[model samples]
Target: MAALKTSTTWIKGQEFESEHDGNKINVDGDKKNGHGPKALLLSGLAGCSGIDVVDILHKMKVEFSDFSIDVEADQTEEHPKVFKDIQVTYRLKTATDNLEKVKKAINLSLDKYCGVSAMLKKNSAINYTVEILN
Candidate 1:
């Protein structure tokens, strides 16, 4: 089995530094120094799926520009709050004829390729929308 490891160290109150494969990020629960952990998870989901979609689109010969993803989640009110649902919006400038191809890439990413999406879906309902721009 392939294993990936990361390390997180406490920096100060509500602040921590996490490192993986020589990359590092600061996570702060207070949101004063860095992004909160929950927010980072949402980013991870977007990044994972985005990478897959880009690769799939490239393989399909679909050209696109200004591609971006916006992710939002509704969190439960209870302690140990968790995401109840997530909304992912994909926007890009591409040929109108490529719409179906883009959608297919995104679907394949979320449904089959994105490990982060697979894990997040265990607890949160994930919804996605695609917008094509000129």
Candidate 2:
């Protein structure tokens, strides 16, 4: 089995510093220092899937540009507020003929390759939309 480790250290107030491998980031609950933990989860999901999509598209020889993802979530009002639903929007500029390939790449990433998405989907409903830009 393979394992990955990370650590978070409290800085002050509601802020913390997190490190993984050689990289580090600041996390704050008040949004004063860095991204909140929940928001980071959304970022992880997007980044994970985005990497998969880019790799798959490249392997398929699908030329694209200006690719970006926007993620939004609806949270419950309970004490342990959690995302009930997540919407991921993928925007890219590609030839009209490659639209199908682009969709397939994104689908593969979200459904098969993105571990973050798999985990998040256990608690939140994940929906996606694709916009092919001119």
Candidate 3:
């Protein structure tokens, strides 16, 4: 048997919830009005790519003092829907400042890893770039 749970969610005067694992995420339609879903999606992408990059970079023995992922999103002009294009910029600031290695790490994330990226790329153009700042 499969277990299920309901997670509450609301947007744009609509009411709904996410259901899984016998739990619920309720959406009261207060703070999260029109931008909650997109925020969650973007967060997923960042987290997915984040884990991959960190793991790959660690395995590659690339020491970084700081790291950050910047996601810039573009919404459609039409109503009742949005997000036509989203640009993801992966900025990795390391002490060594190896551009090639950093770029390679990012490529690996977008191509091999990062399930969110793979899925989103099918619907939208997600271009990623890496900048190594020392």
Candidate 4:
């Protein structure tokens, strides 16, 4: 088991700073000013799965020139809004022959490796697609 800790403190109107593992992240309620909590959560999901995919692919000897993830999520209209649906698009620049291996790596991340995905999926439905550019 692992224990993680974080602290958040208000900076100003609708803005705050979150500290974790010696890093600080600025969060704002106004989307135009900075990332809101929900948006950050979506980014976390993508980052978590992206890290997993990279490690899995490396272990499998799959090579890629570039990789990125794009995520969009729908939120409930009611108070205490939460994500309803989330979609992730993984874009990779790699050899055509590695497409199947890349997909397998993504599947492993989404289905088994990403803790962020597991937590969010308890409330949100997640779907994903892949795009390979060679």
Candidate 5:
């Protein structure tokens, strides 16, 4: 097993630091309201898909100046404050005629490449929409 190192900050609303080899990550439970560990999952999903898209598009030689995934969640008001559904919006731009390749890349990410989506789908419903901006 590979050893992963992470340091947690002790507070009522705690923030922690996770380091893996040469990479560093900061984790705060509640970014805006001093909450729990939900942001980690949300950010993970976004990062996972974001990485997949960039790599896949780059390999296909799709030229783009910017790419971003914006995410929103619908939460339950009861105990645990769990997410009921998540919507991810993607913005993409390219000069290539191979738009189908881009869609395939995204499909592969959501269906296979993203570990976070795989984990979260067990507990909640995840939905996504893509808008190609010229």
Candidate 6:
């Protein structure tokens, strides 16, 4: 297996600049400094799943507009806090008839394709809902 690599540089006051491959991201332990680490994880989850969903939907010939994924996770209150539960809402502006197909696409990503989901699910409970807007 090939190794994935990243490096982080300190930027003072609970802030860091992380580089993956060639892309750089600002991460912070404090919200005022940059994006919180956990929140960035949530974004990664959404992005990973979203990519799968879009590709799956295209192959399924599902046309949609205003596609969005909203993620909310609850974290533990103790030290070394972790996510207890995560909820993902998938919103699609498409025909109601396409709801079933959209759901199928999401299920495929969450259950079989998304690596991030697979990793996160090992520790946190994940649930999802679909909303169709005409």
List the global CA lDDT of all models: 0.95, 0.94, 0.74, 0.92, 0.77, 0.94
- Candidate 3: list runs displaced more than 4 Å: 1-6, 9-35
Give lDDT: candidate 2, residue 127.
Answer: 93
* Alpha-carbon shift of residue 75 in model 4 (angstroms): 1.4
Where is model 2 more than 4 Å wrong at Cα? none
Could you tell me which residue pairs clash in candidate 6?
A: none
C-alpha RMSD of each candidate structure in angstroms = 0.8, 1.0, 4.0, 1.2, 2.9, 1.0
* Ranking of models by TM-score: 1, 2, 6, 4, 5, 3
What digit string (tens of lDDT, one per residue) describes model 2 on residues 1-134? 76988999999999999999989999999999999999999999999999999999999999999999999999999878999999999999999899899889988998899999999989999999999999
Worst 10 residues of 3 by lDDT: 26-35
Q: Please list all clashing residue pairs in model 5, or write none if there are none.
A: none
Give candidate 4 misplaced runs (Cα > 4 Å): none
lDDT of 4 by residue, 1-134 (tens): 78888999998999999999989999999975679998899999999999999999999999897799999998899988888999999999988888899889998998899999999989999999999986
Residue range 59-108, candidate 5, lDDT tens digits: 88777767788878899999978889999887877655656777888888
Where is the poorest 10-residue window by lDDT in model 5? Answer: 27-36
Q: Write the per-residue lDDT of candidate 6 for residues 98-131, one digit (tens) a residue.
A: 9899999999999999999999999998899999
lDDT of 2 at 128: 92
Candidate 5: how many backbone clashes?
0
Worst 10 residues of 2 by lDDT: 1-10
Cα displacement (angstroms), candidate 3, residue 53, comes to 0.3
lDDT of 1 by residue, 22-47 (tens): 99999999999999999999999999
Q: Which pairs clash (backbone N, Cα, C closer than 3 Å) in model 2?
A: none
Model 6 CA lDDT for position 59: 100
User: Could you say which candidate leads in TM-score?
Assistant: 1
